[model samples]
Target: MASLCLTCVSEGTSLEEQVRRIKDIEAIESDSFVPQAFKSSRDDTKSAVVQVKQESEKGPSQDISLPMSIVYDDSGTLAHPSLFVDKETAEELWLNRLISLRQERLMGSPVT
Candidate 1:
């Protein structure tokens, strides 16, 4: 399959040729990451395995792919857990559970 830059190819190749190239690309399953998109880099397979181990050992995993921030409020009468949700929803969920335990203790209740 002939690969062409979508942005500049339109200016050079005929529409029919562009369509044919696109069809060729569509016929093949592309890799998760393009080979030519970036320079050759070191493959950190060991680090990747370590990260997977660490994340798995921590417990349930999440699907968030962005950064997140959370802040806690400590002045509620009902002793509610302040769940600061952002990009990291799983972290927020875990924090909420921990904070709720603290809240229970502050309220003279048993921390479950």
Candidate 2:
């Protein structure tokens, strides 16, 4: 079994909203947060845990090779504070399928 562990980061008006967006993604198997689990060195931003599962023929697996922590920041914090995962880890776990799905979703709609 092979799974992909991702640290989805986002900046929004509400931390809960950002988390909700992550949860809304169909690919995410499960997610949770550890109270004050992360403190950003750049600012007062905080991070939490949100475990995502990728199902494969073998079964479910989580790529623990990288840190799995989701960071949430204020909406004005960054230009495009969107969810992200480690490139190396994604490649290792064959998580490109998820990315492709996301691209397909975005492509179906007109770009603003």
Best by TM-score: 1
- The residue-by-residue lDDT of candidate 1 on 31-63, one tens digit each, is 553445565334322222112212466677744
In model 1, residue pairs whose N, Cα or C atoms come closer than 3 Å (at least 3 residues apart or on different chains), thus clashing, are: none
Residue pairs in collision within model 2: 3-61
What does the lDDT come to for candidate 2? 0.53
Q: In model 2, what is the error at residue 102, expressed in angstroms?
A: 39
Over the stretch 1-112, how does candidate 2's per-residue lDDT look in tens digits? 1222233333323556555665555334435532455664756344544556656788777543333554555567555533355678757556667667678778895432
Q: Which residue runs of candidate 1 sit more than 4 Å off their true CA positions?
A: 1-87
